[model samples]
Structure formats: structure tokens, C-alpha cells
Target: MHVTELLKDWPCTVTGGRPRVQVTGVTERAANVGEGFLFVARKGKRQDGASYIEEAIQKGAVAIVVDRPSLSELPLNVPIITVPDCRKFLSYASARLAGNPSERLTVVAVTGTNGKTTVTHFIGQLLQGLGIRCAVIGTIGIFIEGRRMEYDCPEMTTLPAEYLHPLLAYCESRGVTHVILEASSIGLANSRLAHCEIDVGLLLNIGQDHYEEHGGREAYIAAKGRLLHQAHAIIVNQDDTQCRQMADASERPTLYFGAAAMLGYSTDLILQKLAIPGHYNRLNAIAAASALIALGYTVDDVADQISMLALPEGRLQRLEQDGVQVFIDYAHTPDALEAVLQTLSTICYGKLITVFGCGGERDKGKRAEMGELAVRYSSLVFITTDNPRNEDPVRIVRDIKEGFGGDCSTVEAVLDRKDAIRQAIFRAAPGDIVLIAGKGHEKYQQTATGVLPFSDVAEAEWALSEKTYEGKVEGGSR
Candidate 1:
């Protein structure tokens, strides 16, 4: 595409580069620049992107776009285009380049600390069962019409605009009617979902999961609240005060679910037949039903078939066993970890054995909190490693031990995740439920050195199959 075409609404001038250069691809990172690519020098939170201009030019970046339009330091013969906000411009430019696919289909974006994946999954299931063709973009993977699409991008859940718009375009081309996706707090604050025309936005519940990343809970809430502004209609949690306030302030056509309601369906009708466990999942179902109702489906149309909604993989997933039960769930946050433990505590006939760990390089504040929660619910707790990416496993375990407050009777530190899982499962007897948390559906383990192949369900199954190698995990995959 021509530079003239890409910078349609934004202010630009040819300056010293070619009068009409074509941009074969676009990127914010200078290291990813290749021949004929347009390098966008975005000013990030930690690093100044303008510093990499020479590096991008060295890698054959044909054109450059930046919010800071200064040519005194930059070399001559390169197009220097300016935009008011390069982060927002990146999303809009990618959308325009991808033929504006979000406008062609209904977009339902879900934002929350814990239930974003589950709510998105339930919405797709309900809408698809109602005869609407649907596609899902989430942490598990991208699926279009029930088929997972192949992707290699920087982000796993909320992708950057360059990768996101094209996938939305492909879903549009494949005859999809609705696109459901999970929007993270950091992703929304950075403007990744800026230009997408969201038809219905679901606010599951705001929790203090990324306090360190956003600086505090208020900033995090404000960041995720950006979705409410972009949405035409909102379906929010009436039971949560923060979510209710955010949705009410938007003043858009809003619907409510959970406990109270302006216009919502009763969850009891579906909970009677709902196969998925946990009280949180009951709320996820109501939120999914409300979102579809806002998209023109009647309440009666959604609730009847919503009982068939299955839990997303890695979320309270069950594994096969004879004497004891085992589960694998992706509950990394404090709120999520507590919720899963609380749910399992109710069904546990004998003892609840839990193995969980915190991800390094993230909000360190939640590590100790999760430690306390795990000990409060489980009879035995193994504080293991979960994605220790470039951080010392010993130091991470020490941080989690702080939550025990000098009483380590219930908590034990096992830096090796696989060993911790094996010990927990081996110790379980009849009527006991063993839970492997934190890295549920993840297939890799990131230590201080590097990433290695790992899977909780596979490890747990192997451990369980050892007790009696004939048993296999049945109906576990999503």
C-alpha cells in the first residue's frame, strides 16, 4: 500500500524519502523490520522508540512513522510521518490496511481479570448453538468456525494490531457472523483494540490481578474501562460494584446479569442442567446469555440451550482416575486461585491437595496472596514454579512463603513444577481431589534459563495412569 493511502486521516508529508513509497508490512519493533516494511517508531512506556531509527533504516525500512516528527537528528532521504498518537494510529492503520473487517461482522469483546476466557468461550458456544457462525480469539488459541487457526505473533491473548486486524479480516472472509475475543488490561491501555467496531462488550468482573503492571487497581480499572467506551452495547455484572459503575457511566444501551437485573435471565434455569462446576461459571453463563440478548437474541432463545455450554480447556478441567479425582486449571491471579480452591473445597470428600505457583516478571504482590489462599482451602499445598521467566526460582518461592507468616506446616516449596505435581497426585488417596493450578493449558515452562516443553494435564494423567495405567483422561480437551 502507498504511504499516501496508509496515512489517510493522519497528518503526513513526504519530506526527504520517495514521493510515493509502498509499505509492504508495518511493525513497531525495529528488530522486526525487513525490506519494504514501514517501521512505526512508537513511544512505549519503558523505551523511546525514536532511538531505533538508525537501526530500522539499517534493516531496510523503506518508510518511517512516528509521533515525534524531528528531522534534525535523523538522516536525510527517509519519509518521516507524524501522528498525534502512534499507538492509536497503529490500530487504525492496521484496520484500514486489512479492509476494516470489524465493521463487517459483530464483535463481542470480553475484559476481566479471571473470567474473560470462560465468558468468551460460553458466548461463542451459545451464539453458535443459536445458529450464528462464530469465531473465538483467546488465550487457548484462535478458532474460526470451530477450527483453531495457526498464528505466530508476539502476544498470545490480546494480539497487537498488525496481527489482530488481518486475523479479523480472515474471519470475515470465512463467513463468520460474530467475533469473540479477550481484551487484557495492558492491551486496552496500549490501544491494541482501538479501531475495532465492537458490537457488544462484556465486563465480567474487575479484580486486582495486574496491580503492579498498571501501578494500582484504579488505573487498571480505568484501562479496561476503555472497552466500554468503544462498545455500542454493554452486558455487565450487576453484582460487582466497580463493573456496574463503569457500565452505567458509559450510558450506552446496557444489559445486566448476576444477582440483580434491569433486563436479564435467571441463572437457576440453566444451572439445573449446567455441567460445568464453580459458582463463577454460573455467573459466566449469565454474562454470555446477556451479551447475546443485547445482540438481538431473546432471553428465552439463549437460556434453553446455554445449559450445554462446556467449560474452556484449562479451566476446572477434570482428568480420569479411579480412587481420587484430579483437576487442572489456569488460575494465576489471586482472585482466580481463590475461586478455584473455594469451588473444589465444596466437592472434596476427604482432603484437597493443591499444587500452584505464580508467574515471574508479573505482579509480585499477588504471589503471597495466592499462597495464603491455597493454604486456606487445601489440606496440603505445594508452592511450585509457574513461568519463572528470567527470575530465580528460589527467590520466587521465598516471596510466596511470606504469605504463610512463619507457619510453614501446610505450605511446602517445590521449585520443580513437575515434581510438585507428581508428589501431590501420588499422595492423594480415595475421596481426595488433587488440583494442579497456574499453568493449566500451557504447553511450555519458562525458567530463568529458557522455555521447555510442559503440560499439567499430561503430567497429571501420566501420574494417575501410573497408579493404574489402564485409566485415561476422558472428555478433557476443549
Candidate 2:
């Protein structure tokens, strides 16, 4: 494509000469620049891309797109296309350059503070059960035509415009009929999903999260509502007050899914017979079922798939060891923590031992709330470190303890996560339920320094194994 063709709607001027520049590719990162590529100089949190323009040109970039009109430092020969927001233009230019592959497949985007991953997984599973070929992009990673690709990308949380065509192209090659994605508030705010056509959008529930990045609850809700406006049909949780408002704002055809309505398809989205247990999960299930139904599946088809659906790995997953029940959930947010703890409270006739921690560098406001919920519900609360990235575990523990109102006999601080889990297991007796909250199926613990390989399921299994092995050895001696 010629430089003139790509700069449509973008303010550009050929300063030195009107040389016909034919660029083969486009990139926001200077490192990715190759022969005939157009490098976009974007201002990011870490560094400014304008600083790397010399390097990009050295690598044979034919054109450059930037927020500024002219730079004294930059070469006058290269065409500069100035835009008010380069990030917004990045999505459009990248999509056009990549051949607009998203138009070829039915794309369903799911966004919320919680249940986005679970709902996406459930939707993919339900579609698979209905014999439809579908692909999913979320916390678990991308699924293409039933095959799991192990590559991890931030695009899973926020669909980047750069990878949009590549993913759609991959799905197209694999014969995938539908694509399901978990769109985060950050992704929506940053214009990641701007160019992509969302066929259907599912809003699970809104909660106070990512306030630091989204500014406040209102801004976060507005960012999530962006998807609602773009979707052809919006499926929402009627039980959520914010969701009700979001549904009303959307011009698209809307469907309601919740446990409050026994008449809806979500009436039994979360059943007692499932491997995972939670009323909140029931809401997630119903939302997913309604999404599938809107995608053209019959009521029976939706129910069969949803009923047979199992919780993905560690999202509200449960295990039984020596008459003790252990529930592992990915509840990082305060709402998630409260929901999981409340569910365990109902199921555990004996006692609910909660082992939870807050992540560092995230929404710090939720720490105290999580602490309060843990104290209120659990028979025993263990406050521990959970990916305290760059933040002192002691300080994080103190913030959580603050929520306990100073006389916290029920809560104990343990900075080491593994030790916390160990102590929770040791403290629990027969018929007790141990709730391992946060870092559900994730294989690594993210710290401010680095990522330490970790998995809650693996740790729980090892603990269970050690106990069983000890029991067998004692029995053998007896």
C-alpha cells in the first residue's frame, strides 16, 4: 500500500518532497520496525516512541505517525502523519492494513469487573457442547478450534489492534466460526477494541475495581459501557444496579439473566451438583447461557451445555481431602472475595477457614473490604501475601489488618503465601471447608520484582498428597 492510502483521515504533509513511499507494515514499537514499515510514535507510560524514530528510520521505515505535527530532531524526508490521538488511529490503521479479518467471524465480547473469564470459558464450553466451533480469548488464553495455544499476551485482557488481524487470521485458518473475548475496562479505555466489530456483548456485573487506572467507579463503568454501545445485543445481570443502568443506556436489543428470575434461562446456571459452588457463579452461568441463546442456540441446547459445563480449572474449584472440603477461587476483587467467602459460609456446616491476600499495585481500596469480608464469614482468617508486586508484604498485611478494627483475634498475618496455605490446612479439622482465595489457577505469583511459578491447585494437591502419604505410612506401620 502507498503512504497516501494509509494516511486517510490523518493529517499529513510531505515536507521535503512528495516521494511515493510504499510501506509494507505498521508498528507502534520501534523494535518491530522492518523494511518499508510505518512506525507509529506513541507516548506511553514507560517511554515515548518519538525518541525511537531515528532507530525506526534506520530499520527502513517508510512513514511515521505521531501526535505532534513536526519535530526539529526528526528527518524532514520521512512523511509525518499527525493525529490528535495516535492510539485511536493505531487501531484503525492496523485493522485496515491487516485486511479487516474480524468482519469474517462472529465475535462476542464479555466485559466486567468479575466473571469475565468464567463467562467466556462457559460460553466457549457451551458452544463446544452445542457442536459449534468457537475460539476464546481470556485469562485461560486463546482457544482455536478446540486446541489450546499456550502463548500469553496482554491482548487476552485487552484486545490490541496490532494482534487483531493475526488472531482473526489464525481463527480463519483453523475454521473457527465464533470468537469469544474477555474485554477489560483498561482495554476499552485505551481504544483496544475500537476497530473490532463486537457482534454481542455480555456485561456480567460491575464493581469498584481498577480505580487507580480508570480514575473512579463512574469512569470505570463508563469504560465498560463502551462495549454495551458497540454490541448488537447486550446481555446483562438484572440483579446488579449498575447493570440495570448500563442495559437501559444501550441501544442494542437487551436480555436479562439473573437468579432473581426463575423464568429466565439462568434459573439454574449454577447448580448444587456442579464441581464449583457459588451463587455468584449461578449469575455468571445464567449470563453465559443467555449469551449463547442470543447467539442462536435453542433453550434446550443452552440448558444442556450450561448444565454439563464444569468450572474452568481454578475458578471456584473445589477439592475434598480426608473429609475436608477445599475451595480454590480466583477472587482478587473485594466483591469476588465476599461472594466466595459467603458461599463457603453456607456450605461448611463445621467451619470455613479462609486463606486470602491482596495483590500489590492493584486497587488498594479493596484490601480493607476483603479483610472485613474474610473476618465476617470465615471461622478463621489468614491474611497472607498475594503477588505483593514491589510493595512490602508487611505493609500490605497492615492495610488488611486495618479493616479488622484492631481487635482481630480471628485474623492472623502470614507474609509467606505457601506457609499461609499450610497453616490453614493444619488448623482445619474434619468436615471443615478451606477457602483458598486469589491466584486461582494461575501458575505464577506476580511480585513487584519478578514472577514466581505458583499454582493454588498444585499447592493444594501437594498438601493433600503429603497428608495422605503420611496417613498411609502410619497405617502400614500399625
TM per candidate: 0.93, 0.91
Report lDDT (CA) for all predictions: 0.83, 0.80
Cα lDDT tens digits for candidate 1, 227-252: 98888888788888999899877968
Name the regions of candidate 1 deviating beyond 4 angstroms.
Answer: 12-14, 30-35, 45-60, 70-73, 260-262, 468-478
> Which 10 consecutive residues of model 2 have the lowest summed lDDT?
469-478
**How many pairs of residues in model 1 come into backbone collision?**
0
TM-score of model 2 vs. true structure: 0.91
Candidate 2 lDDT over residue span 365-421, tens digit each: 988888888898988998888889899888888888878775578888887888888
What lDDT does candidate 2 reach at residue 280? 83
